[model samples]
Target: MRGEGGTRRIVVIGGGIAGLATAALLARDGHSVDLVEARDAFGGRAGTWEQDGFRFDTGPSWYLMPDVFERFFGLLGTSAAAELDLRQLDPAYRVFFEPDSGPSGGTGSPPAPPSAAHAERDPIDISAQTATNVERFEAVEPGAGRALERYLASARDTYDVALRRFLYTSFTSISPFLHADVVRRAHRLVPLLLGSLERFVARRFREPRLRQILGYPAVFLGSSPDRAPSLYHLMSAMDLTGGVLYPQGGFGHLMDVLVRLARENGVRLHAHTAATEILTETDRGHRGRGRGRRARTTGVRVRDQTPGGGSERVLPADVLVSTADLHHSETTLLPRELQTYPESWWDRRTSGPGGVLVMLGVRGSLPELAHHSLFFTRDWPANFAAIAGGTVPDPASAYVCRPSATDASVAPAGHENLFILVPVPADPGLGHGGTDGGGDPAIESIAEAAIEQVSQWAGVPDLTERIVVRRTVGPADFAEDLGAWRGGILGPAHTLAQSAFFRAGNASKRVAGLYYAGAGTLPGIGLPMCLISAELVQQRLREALR
Candidate 1:
């Protein structure tokens, strides 16, 4: 660790994964760190809630990238696995597709005869009651599972070379790629970048349902399968190889461990504290020279609303790291003149859509359910088209996480904790301020439709009646609560242009002593990337201080 003489005083805005990770790292390195979060608690969007003795993780049920979590705790000379019970789920998750209808109007397609290829193998039918449909699913696409395995194998290679070697590298400038070491690796990454995920999968499998199931993750990045880069196939590899995991207790347990690590290392966390303004002192003489103009962030004005919404206080700091939504921090927090990017630049930065989440506590356990389940829409292309067109899809594919299936601590003795999410277009009709087009009814209707669809797929009778408690979150609420620009769940879309160096720089182009980490910045979304973004910012800040 370095001495405190040159130690930078840092304040991080937004206590999301990025903010907390940054604070922990900086503090571990002997820097003075204070984390001011707008929310009443830390964890930002991934926070949790407890109601009537049942606990729920409000956002991000899937915990991928175990390495990111390990690296985060490594900075504090500990490991996340030591504190958190992260169990790798077997059979990863189940995918539910609409039961096939026969030639004219039957419930399912024609049943398939047992294939010689897997005569001795045990068939895994997620939709068991729809046995006839499962056989039809196999019949429609012979060797569909085998093709998926092959696709995943190739994707695993891409993950090894692209994500492990390239994505994590902090490219302060593009000049490094011109080096021979990087040049050699470019060949592998280039092909994947140029190709489309849809085409890549189509070349291997002929089944429409299997194609939809395999290609769905790309939509999380807001890119159509036909448009998304083939490199995105690495996402599937992560799930297939690493396996989806959930922390014991809940996702918030991970947050709690992080907070403890930060506090132990001398990082100060101010919950219920909102940073209203950023105070910067810039060298006027160096303005507009396209050169060095050293600036120091003197302090932040925080509004403490804990005690009847009282006055503000100025907390001093030498540097500032913002893990809040990059667009929100740039457009709303900083002075207009200090925002280097124009409206057009921001307008072109197309963030992906927000999510409609349904948190439910069921009265009794559902034995057939898995820890994670995905109910894909029948027409995925149309659903995506609606989102791209800035309208909520009439029928959206949905995902459900039943943590209680694996961990008993989430709910009471015999109850279950269910979290369902459906991605919808950002509200307010795109060009206008983000607002749900049809308001509460529209969002609720989407949830209701999803519940009905999921219930049918799961073969549950009167599923809605079993719900003991329920809470719904819409796009508007996400925007207001998280300061998301368009209520986007995963930050800007990870299109080819928006990814890598194209993402907003970790440090502001206009503001000195200001840095960014989290989904809205570099390395993109998910817990792993967000943590890496914080590390990248820490490296940049360390170099600047030197």
Candidate 2:
């Protein structure tokens, strides 16, 4: 609500969630803001596809971390409850443990499963109510009901600490962690920061299925539970305790709201406009030897996408914030000498998992599927290994979102809508997806396998027969369309070193007035994190202006 400094010309590249949020915030702060998108429409990966009365949300299905959403909206002088229809899902999501999932072969010795690992049972529903979820846990493992309560209680403490002392800290300086409140609690965080989430969950629960439920949330953070620091177990409190929810109209509606917020705040949004290069000039005021090397961005070169006849021209800017992939924005847009994060720097980085997104318009009902369902293979470690190693595991762990189960607008009278995500290695060589399941044979194969896997596990025998429409997206599309690094679908993987203060910062190290926002920057992945990244840019700009 406050314009901290005098107005300046701000150019924001990429009209994705982060970009829109950034533009809105900066514009509200009395700046002349312009946002450009390479694609004809906005939303980037958080896009929508419609066909024959079926509407599919291509990305970001689950709405978790409500507090973060409210905070972002609050910053815009609005409220989430006032601006959108939000619902908390009871039986938050269903989980289907693969029937033959007990044997762990590839990833060395996993904790031995409790007896009855594959007992025949209905797909389990994790309820919004903690007690209901406790009963479900107790049904399989005796005494686990009490254990669930204890685990969640611990998760709540960690989540609270993270929200106050970590997540929102911005890491712009070390002072955040050095605060008295943070230092007083620092001793409690040592073990959590040192261990892996997988080990953290295993010590609390013995049941493989229960462990899977607790550990799987790491994927939401774009990491394997075993690889992510145990500090991430805070995610369990969000889904298991805080509960999952959905916007009444899907993330596309959220996109509409973002655009509205940006426009109302004076951000000029440019559709089908792509930034080709970042223009820079030597600082005339710098009376030193390194004057040429100490140049600042003057503007950006934008390409006019007017079909057969268009060229590039500069869009002036006093400051630049790129919500485009940081790797591309730094390596491709900026000159080599001016690049803050050069191509060689990325060569040493690891990308998060790429995804095969399948949007299916099924002709019949899917009573077995929930608004959110997770089909987890027992040998998840092996599947995780295959994905990290660039091999599509035959029995892969995947997710299914059947929004029609809650919102009828997504599908026709008698039909159902399904969005499937199968995480794979971030390799564009996997090729691209196509309409009606007719993509590169490799991409389509992944879709087919995922469909069959869901059918068998969810007990929907005729799943494939009911699919009347299908569309898929592979890693290559993420690379070409979103400029994702290494075709990774969810920015950089949140590995230990790549997390927290170690992740990409919001400001350009080389270009004084240049900044970056989005999943690729600090605070890490997800819609909420990217929103926070935009706020971090605001914070950085304020510091510079002051």
Candidate maximizing TM-score:
2
lDDT of 1 by residue, 1-546 (tens): 234678978899999888998999988888989999987889998899888778989887878777777877787798876888888776577777655422311112223343422321212223322233335345657766556656767777767666555566566766646756557768777888888887777777655555665677786665678767888888876665566777898889888888888899899999989989888787564556564434546778889868687679998877888898888887877877677554567888777877788888888877656888877655666777778778777667788889998888889988988888888887733221112223477676777787787777788877889888777788778788888878877788878787777777777766678888998777887788888988888789778877
Candidate 2, 226-264: lDDT as tens digits: 888888887878887768988988999899999999999
What is the C-alpha local distance difference test score of each model? 0.75, 0.85
Q: Compute the lDDT for candidate 2.
A: 0.85
Candidate with top lDDT is 2
> Please, what is the TM-score per model?
0.88, 0.95
Q: Summing lDDT over every window of 10 consecutive residues in candidate 2, give the lowest-scoring window.
A: 105-114
- How many backbone clashes are present in model 2? 0
RMSD of each: 5.3, 2.5
- Identify the runs in model 1 with alpha carbons over 4 angstroms from their true place: 1-3, 100-140, 143-150, 175-181, 284-296, 428-439
Clashes by residue pair, model 1: 100-108, 427-435, 428-435
